[model samples]
Target: MEKLELTPPPAILFALEPLRAMADYVASLAPASQPLPQGDGHPVIVFPGLGVSGYATEGLRERLKELNYEVHDWEQGVNQWPDTEFDGFLDLLSEQLKRIHSQNGRPISLIGWSLGGVYARELAKTHPKLVRQAITLATPFADQPNSTHAGWLFTLLNGGVSPMDEALLRRLSIDPAVPCTSVYSPSDGVVGWAGCVGTESEYHRNIEVDNVSHWGMLHNPEVLRVVARLLAEHRRGTFRTLLDTCVTKLL
Candidate 1:
């Protein structure tokens, strides 16, 4: 196993992020890419990363939709620090999840990216009954803020953060009661990959997709296929080996 890196990624890997992001786009459009393990029409909510909006997740959401899930983006505007409307966002999120679950009579699935993954875990803690499972993409919820290269940008956007922020960081590391998955890449260019990994158990699994960059996690086709497989199962599974047996072998 590679070292569980505590510091930000090296400059070379960080520098490759934008280029890998571009290649992800090309790969998504290539005829070779295909959806595996089709979804079961469960409702899913996708949360965006920091400094981005739902638009950034359009491709990912579209892929989920193609897999037969009822997918919806957060629609929470740009993900800004000092989010003044977060309480309101949570309120609306609760309404949507409850409504979807009531209508469909199935627990909703959550797919969150980066900072948004924090929201998903906390939300599931409070409403585990409404959530079937959760999947986090490049989310460093278990790490200190400074472990990420983008920490400074968060501080700059919010002026300064308080020491109490560590309390939330600890809370983020707590696994949700329902099934959960944390997808990580060793060469992640933004957040430290180690912190993105949650403690693994029967209901919670950490998976490694080595080719992904933090910036490329959203639209990378393999990531989509992984999510599709988990959602199709509609329950917890031996997903740690899913990439090796399902994703790689299919390719």
Candidate 2:
């Protein structure tokens, strides 16, 4: 496989994040007046992106809660890259997943944002029986980690460690054993959009939303609508590609 370098978005486009966030916030409000599919009270865990706490995902978690899902935040404080071979952070996350699964008496759904999505996919692969499904927002697991705008920051935080170490990158490219959805935007300012595509499988899908910034994903109404519909389909025991769902909506 050819090595891919980080392809950051244009500075001008990246700079529009704040404005896009505001627009998304305004658009998100409109979803309240529209009918949304109700959730089935299944447990869903929301993971924050790198260097952020649960606060980063509060809007999304609240929306999922409003839709009647039992949602939990990954309260593990700021998510730092693992420093040890054992990966204590992932171990802690694993324990949390098992705890949540045992407590709910059912498999849990995982929603990861950016780096958190990478974690979600790995967790599902390791603990498939404990995961109902995995959903990722702008996660770049399919490409070299340096292909993200945050790559420099990640390297700095990890004592100049490279995330593209052969073994780790290979693992990231493998498909998880559970149903997966990757929500990505071609205009994402932080990570290369091509890096976010999930492995194609009978249970995996890649959904593209136009003109949304990476930061705005949490508040984007269109993204939320897609999530809501997917949750509803999961609840109904129906498996449909996002393309199929979009076609149904057009009809």
TM-score of each: 0.88, 0.90
Displacement of the residue 49 alpha carbon in candidate 1, Å:
0.3
Best by lDDT: 2
Candidate 2's C-alpha runs over 4 A off are 1-6, 31-33, 235-243
Candidate 2 lDDT score relative to the true structure: 0.80
Return the clash pairs for model 2, or none: 6-147
For the record, the alpha-carbon RMSD of candidate 2 to the native fold, in angstroms, is 2.7
Superposed by TM-score, candidate 2 places the C-alpha of residue 82 at a distance from the truth, in angstroms, of: 2.5
Candidate 1 residues 1-251, lDDT tens each?
34466788777888888998888787778763543767789889998998899998998898888888998887667776435554565666688778878898888889999988877876787788999888899988778878888888777667676332666677778988887889888888888888888767756778788788888898777777677777777444344454345445545
Model 1 poorest ten-residue lDDT run: 234-243
Model 2 poorest 10 in a row by lDDT: 234-243
lDDT of 2 at 237: 26
> What is candidate 2's lDDT per residue for 1-251, written digit by digit as tens?
34445477677767787887788788877736567789888899999898888999998999899999999998788877666553566787899899988888888889999888988898888888888888899889887766677888888778887656878787887878677889999889888888888656667778898988888888887788778877766532223555477437623
